[model samples]
Target chain A: MSFFYVDLSVNQSKTWEKLFFDLKGTKRYNKYCQDADFYNVFKQIILSLLLGEEIVLLDADFSEDEIKRLTANSIYETDDILVNKQLESIESKEDLFQHLRQINKEWQITLYTSGTTGLPKRISHSFQSITRFVKKSENHSSNVWGFAYNPTHMAGIQVFFQALLNGNPIVRLFGLSKEQIFESISEFAVTNISATPTFYRLLLPKFNQYPTVKRLTSGGEKFDEKTTNALKQIFPNAKITNVYASTEAGTLLASSGNNFFIKPEFKGLIKVIENELVIHKSLMGNSDIFSDEWYHTGDIVEIISQNPLNFHFISRKNEMINVGGYKVNPHEVEEAIREIDGVSDVRVFAKSNSVLGNIICSEVVINNDSLNESLIRNQLQTKLQEFKIPRLIKLADKISTTRTGKIKRN
Target chain B: MKKEKLLEIINTIKKNRNEVLINSIDETSDLRNDLGMESLDLAELTVRIEAEYDIDIFEDGIVNTIGEILNKLENKR
Candidate 1:
């Protein structure tokens, strides 16, 4: 278990530490990712866990020996070694203003996301923006929160960093599990839960079980009506909220409950041109992607409700798969796929096609092997638009994900 | 039986009907072809199905299994 030290009292010192064993002895838990090496990675993890080290800078382009060279420069109480992992990979050039900037009366969070390209895009958040979302739940209800996304992933990691930084407790199931989440809710008395629309679906079955939970928040990807309605019904006592933001942009747009009410406190300015969402660069506040005081949100939203706020998510621009002349947003088609039973994970992409110009393809990851390709395709026919359906569906042992819990889409 | 159940699940999800329609979905559908499901959605659905139906569809599965999933969900009812 990795632990970090936090000072609870000025006169005294405080440290938080815990040991975690893979509850699922699904032995493969230790089977490392192809992303990094075997030895140094574990070495770094052990040192960081045993010692109270918060940040470990990794240089992806650097050799392991080079990591050791940097480690020599690292001054920590623990013999923590640096691994060429996410901390290094999320690296982007820091703004020189970061040196000129003085932080006072506010907390700051540095955000790095896996954006449209596989590259990690970094953004900065003031205490007001990132933590403000978490604090918004103060007047809310919930018994437990499930924090399962990898911390290396910008969205999930923020949860990991903040849960401790804010003195909030959380539990992680081996993978995302409603059963495990329900168990944790009862076990830990958790009330507020945060997840991506994808992760929320994992725990969909457990909502009815938690009488104490009243707040459910989702981010990282699109949250559609089906998902919103499902969460509303499952946690009838809870409020379901969805936020639209990129790693480069943070906590930008939020919708509340089944009403999907947009929050009014957002200072960001938005414009929709040709069904695309655009933002004034100045609206980013302390964010990085808005260098010129304007940023284009590659998302589509409509002004659905005006009483309490401004807009609702309509669709996505990045999710668009160029299929010949027509641009197909993957999220638009993904909604149709979420209903099928026994299916675990799905991703849609466009492949060059001589006839259609580009044909859609999907990679499906499932635990059940009995259902074959035809059954799935037939099922798709019942729910999805024809062109949105995948031309081919390949079985994936596991869906490849960036450290940020987002599927790697090229 | 599988095809009928699969069709039912697809219909329920399409409506935004607050229900966990499929307790067990697998490779039988070209998930993209049959259900248009993505990898993250599939993973999340697997957990919800397991929790709602109280089924152990993950048994004998190292990653994700169609054979094992079918065997487990078949007797869930």
Candidate 2:
């Protein structure tokens, strides 16, 4: 009676037996445009990979124009060599699991970037590269995952592979409200949760502790000390970790805290050049953007220790706003605002101004209505320089997020 | 009325920094010299005024005095 996935929104659950049953006769598409339910999307990815076929995943909420732009208006076109391959039926769930564990093929999975800074780029990964960080052990079999990322993105694919390979049940928690997310976590007794810092920030000002969660993973955005501390309070029993991954590359580094250390096996595969993290071409997916041997990650990291080779993310290189000749990192400003009492969430960005080429601006979500622009400005004045403090502050009911759950920069 | 509103905005910015508030302002008062406002402060003043009057006082070029801001607003009206 092992369950595959549980959908709290519909109050429906699917079993491992049903997954195998559906896979027996499921129609396989070489280049699938999956804008369907989470169960179906997961099922299609598994079926395609099992048959050694290529698959393209698109966000379910993407507009028709966006889909056209991503696919170059060729959604139904397939250039895959394995387009005509037949789907093989497995006799039992054990056989399916065995196939997954022993599977090695040239099957490619395509994913689009969240496009926070500019247009999303399409990157393709081989089966081996996508599952390079997936761990399989008897201990992992008992862990229940609270899936909280978009199924079409890189982080979600990593979670799916990890859970599927370990035979763990996943409780869907993406796109759920703060109250609903907690409700699902308690109801399912979810043990492991992986999501962005923005997703975790929405659950701030904690009310009740969920001791069932034993592990929490933060990725896709900067995991600040404030959010990490709040997560510790909510998931008191969980061991929190941060994973560094991207659309261009799958999971590469994992850290117990905000600081990351390159594993001994991956020492040569990763390096830092002028503050930007660089990855070897061997570790990245197939994209024209990686013509060089080292792919510039465009992420700026601050080195914390030289002996242990420890570093932590600072901010994206493109995220720095030039405000009147002063470089302002919005993350720094946002962190200062987050430390202030009564603030639920804050998004600091740049606004085109006639005076300063670009002026720092922020939209803040606060629990206390008495928190006003001047009060926040005064508090920030002590922590940040005059140019770093946002020139314009707007109170928002909630901070908007991209399709991949990262805070919307624009 | 616009002059009073501009004075209030200026005082709010001053109050946040614990600076002495100015009760009255004239058209000839220099923003940087007389009011002791820096470039960042002027930037904030630009946005606050844009929010209130729907006009960017520094859109065309740098405005060094309250008279320039009021003139920008008056032109918009």
Candidate 3:
């Protein structure tokens, strides 16, 4: 009853109060019941809160069958694959609450950077650190960003907390096709939208059939020229923007509402240490848990803008793929391939090459349901810088996505 | 576009277009569901709207809401 559970079957969009009623009527959910209301997950979560258990809420897109399968088979038990020495799980709701509350006492949040580059990193966020992003919705667009990413991820978790405190309307848009997102938008009269380049890029071609959007926002992955232009083409003239937040460092930098931004000064001095930009937050990692203010943001961005801090994305310090003398950012090649029409999504990476030191290889997601290779190749030729072009492109029916919405990059 | 004309345009894009006309959306009916426009449909609808309204929306400064879009359409007339 305390949870606001949405009824997906109903034609009407339920207000939080209506959802609260649905929750009241619903029985306590075990992890397995298919069609179990997501709000039930909240109830289980709240129940876990009272009982001191750390419950991992998977994205609702997973069917009951899938949840049963994954929970039964997931490799969380093995610490071997845990990135950044973060394999250990904390026990109890009390453990999380204490850690979070103490952090909240002195700080506002602890966000984990998406592991798109290499490994996920933990970034400390004071209430002040996220002021822009916290009020991010109210200040920019009115549309609620449905938990587009996974709650297990930092962005999703932050959005969850932000929506809870702000009373914003955000449904979990798991497994729903682009069609469903459009439905949610019009149904909610949604005015603001946030998504990754892949999410929007995949949905862009379909824009030819949808209603006009009010605001469009994207981040996470490479928000390159072709993707931005494609978004513009789809939205016509929606308020489009991006941010450059990382996990190890929270909100270290943000782009202006326009694609370009002047990198803001850190509370502490920031510098490009050994070509890798190291930013010093007054505090970094987990909580007021650690007090080291000077932290290196292992991201390497070419300093194109600074006063208002505008920096062009160069490459991740560790993810740079060198081809002979040519330094290639995986994102750069992905962006190039993305520029190619019919290329729905791309994951470009380095492979051992005899000619080039590390040759570029791409896994491309296309609407092979209807493919026109010539048109795409032509488009890629025009938009992409020669070296940035992928040497090989493999068409995929579905790109392997992490449990989170992020495409698996490794 | 007149209600009937709008209905016709929408119908061509959707499977059951007459149902949309029968539904009769004004400011309240959500185009995505009440009218049956999916995400792809919305993208297509905007293209139609842009062609019909002869306006540039979905940019940095363009109006981005349904109500605002409707108001813009009304004003254009």
lDDT of each: 0.50, 0.86, 0.52
| TM-score preference between candidates 1 and 3, better one | 3
Give the top-scoring candidate (lDDT): 2
Per-residue lDDT over A50-147 for candidate 1, one digit per residue giving the tens place of the 0 to 100 score: 22233332423345564344345333335424332222211111221132133244334443454446444545555445444554234322223455
C-alpha DockQ of every model: 0.02, 0.63, 0.01
What candidate 2 gets wrong by more than 4 Å, as runs, is: A28-30, A79-91, A102-104
lDDT of 3 by residue, B1-77 (tens): 55555665566555322232344546665665466554434444555566677653342243333555576667767
Docking class of 3: incorrect
**Model 2 lDDT tens row, A1-410:** 28899988878799988887787665435475566589989988887778766788998878888888888878757654433434454666577787776555778899888877667899999989999999988888798999998899999999999998888888999888788899999998999999988988888887799999999998877778877888888999999889999989999999898789989888778888899999999999998778999999999999887656789999999988998888998888999999999898999988788878888889999999899988998899889988898877899989987788877777
- Predicted candidate 3: what Cα RMSD to the true structure? 20.5
- Clashes in each model (backbone N, CA, C under 3 Å)? 48, 0, 38
lDDT accuracy of residue A205 in candidate 2: 84
Residues A1-410 of candidate 3 have per-residue lDDT tens digits of 12232334344344555543443444433322122354554444433333323344454555556545555554234232112311123343234334433332332333334445443343444444544356534453333545565554455555555554444566655456777766765555454556666677666665553234556656665577766777677666476767665554444444534334533445235665565666565434454324555565666766654554455666667678776567877876676666655677878776554334565656887755565433444466677655555544567766666655565645
Model 3 alpha-carbon drift over 4 Å, by segment: A1-15, A18-132, A136-143, A208-212, A256-270, A287-293, A306-308, A324-326, A353-357, A367-389, B1-77
